[model samples]
Target chain A: MKLLLLSNSAAPGRSYLDHAREVIAEHLDGVTELLFVPYALADHDGYTAKVAAFMDTLGIRVRGAHTAREPRELVASAQAVFIGGGNSFRLLKSLQRHGLVDAVARRIRADGVPYMGSSAGTNMACPTLRTTNDMPIVQPVSFDTLGLVPFQINPHYLDPVPGSAHMGETREERLRQLLEENDVPVLGLREGTWLRRSHDALELGGLAAGARLFTSGAEPVEHAPGADLSPLLAAEARFDCRPD
Target chain B: MKLLLLSNSAAPGRSYLDHAREVIAEHLDGVTELLFVPYALADHDGYTAKVAAFMDTLGIRVRGAHTAREPRELVASAQAVFIGGGNSFRLLKSLQRHGLVDAVARRIRADGVPYMGSSAGTNMACPTLRTTNDMPIVQPVSFDTLGLVPFQINPHYLDPVPGSAHMGETREERLRQLLEENDVPVLGLREGTWLRRSHDALELGGLAAGARLFTSGAEPVEHAPGADLSPLLAAEARFDCRPD
Candidate 1:
């Protein structure tokens, strides 16, 4: 069982969601039961209904993952577990508040659930949620999440804005700083792109995309999707999840 | 005295130190006794040499502001402060390790020193350094920074790689998160762009290039050099920097 991560909720007239849907249909054709998390949708106008309707169109019924006693049972028994996107912080907060963080982590690691995450959904798989560029809608206190994936996922990456005075750091520059401070690989994924990691190697999964693997001594290499990522993923897994 | 911030070092073939020349010549036409900070220089391959060369390139001689026994004296005696760009994390860490955080903050606010920052230099002006996308080569344990600017800055606006699968939040999505979390304004500057904040107000500055500002309940607006940012800057100053 794998969790499919969607960066945003699938709804009417949004092209980005459609790309996510296509990836699900192609990779998870036979899977049926899925737990949908539209945590970012709590306040959006009509967003909840829109997500429900969108799942209906995809032939996958969406429900709150924590609605049941053992959501992992549903996840483990299902053909696939899909985590829809919204706000990374909100969804993570909801998970932490519900005490489902550990449950979700156990499911993804032990239950063989195929986890596909997009955007916010994708963000939860990392070791810490701090890597997200999303506004800190909710501070989780602890950045611990599913940890199915070790590296930070930078989705829909766009370069820094030009010729203006607003200064913090460029997205790439920030990620570069993260890379230098910690030995982790931050995959900068654009829309309609994803990485599939099997064991010690990672492979670019979706549309043509470039990813950067940051490590010590070696210059970060920008590679396109469909390239092997297993080596990177496997190598990074050696580091324990214990907080520094 | 004012602080001048630069986004990155400088365009290729144009040494960042040379940028200092232009700034001193144009911005500080009548000023003397300047201070320079190369925080991001920690990650550069040859930052020390670069800094030395940049200092040498100046027709007039200046002293390193870092030499002061206290951050206050360093900032107080200077006609203006200049921060050179490199890696934000390294620069911030150096400041923190040297215990210059509050010193820099006091100099900027209490002392009323005119300050300018560019590239990584500009990144340090925000109250919290979390907005920077630079990889954390060094962690200062606190995001609190010089509060010279309220909003986060995205410098060196570049585009996503053409045709890539690493899809997720595009650069705009990242800024959206910043805006959602920050009721304050966010400025995205291209190379050679800048914003000036004085008297609790922010105004677009220099660079014929473009800049973008993101705020709540409104669309992003473009800013040209010398545009008024008082309203934006004032509201941001009111925002709570403390996380919930």
Candidate 2:
């Protein structure tokens, strides 16, 4: 299995996908066409057009899954898959509703199709959508995702603001509460950082801002770019949840 | 119906419930015993104990509903009910799992039991938990909440930071996306603000931070403390979701 899971698509001042242009190009080398899943956001055509325009500059053609008559078939025959970010619940529901969750997962595991995701797309690679920071704008069939990765991923993870007066739970506190329920590790990927998985090996790469690794009963540990995170792939995931 | 929906339980540097002590006292003027729902957080006993200790100062006796053999029956007999803050999904799931959603709603509408909620508790008063800022750490039987209010509430609503580089959805953007799917107006309550409902009357109360009101296809309008918001009680809510 090969995957490029980005924490987010854009950075502060850079254009969309500009911050990770080199990494994305290297990851999609030799791929002529990329299937784009744009169900996370409400505007499918607009989102696909934006991505298609960006990929055109790289000599790659982008086709939206929503535009296909049989999205499942598109996923099955795709050379490469790229899922963009927006709302995780909306994206998961669309994938499940269209019966493409298993198809996408099969392509990645069985056919070794290169899978790339950003933000909500990165969350889809996790065992469950339970670690997402997005609002529950919509309810999916379940919190379960593709399970492309064994552990959970909290994308665009933010640190607690210093001396802020907001009474809401910090990103870290929310992740801690998740640990209290499920026996799985969570990788809190800050913006500009990403995880690349190739079969048995996983590497953290991107800008200077690294990522935090959160495990049950242990304090979060930070890992910088170029750090090896393959050990986490071996951790077991036991979700303590019941579906109605 | 009488309700005290608080955005949060505490503010920075302030003790629990201190910010809303006077309002709480006024809301529960004639009540001697208050039933506490602590299902949002993992430590039910600890959460109940903390609220029990705080309510004791106001000459009110507090009972943990989790300790009762039949929590539904406790809601039926209670003079008032207070649900504290934590994960909204966890709170909604626990209430649904234990069959307390209808019980609490019945008490508020039929028995006129003064109802109070902080954070996740306040979110429970809405038609659904779609507007909650918390992560979807757990999937409830449904997004269907108590529906005590006709609309949704986004608690701890924060305005966009001027120059932050975080690529995650802003509080405003998330709520806007929600409007795209559902025909409902949402009340964005800031840290120190709350909504008080008494039969046909509704008012915004608390500090000067004020609150923002978001309606579909329209710009979010701001409302100051002491602003009359009863008109919103008449707005219709149509949730566009399918339960799996």
Best by TM-score: 2
The digit string of per-residue lDDT tens for model 1 on A1-244 reads 3444433333334553665667667656665555655555344335435655656776776666555665555554555555556666667766776666777677667766666677777778777664665544334445567787766677656556787444345777666655555666667765556765444445675555465555545666777767866555444632222122
Clashes of each: 94, 0
Q: Compare the candidates by DockQ and give the number of the best one.
A: 2
Whole-model Cα lDDT per candidate? 0.60, 0.91
- Cα DockQ of the candidate 2 complex: 0.74
Candidate 2 residue pairs in clash (backbone atoms < 3 Å): none
Candidate 1 displacement at residue A188 in angstroms: 5.5
TM-score, model 1 to reference: 0.70
lDDT (10s digit) by residue, model 2, range A69-173: 789989978999999999888899899989989999999999999999999999999999999988888777788899999999999989999987666789999
Candidate 2 whole-model C-alpha lDDT, 0 to 1: 0.91
Predicted complexes: DockQ each: 0.13, 0.74
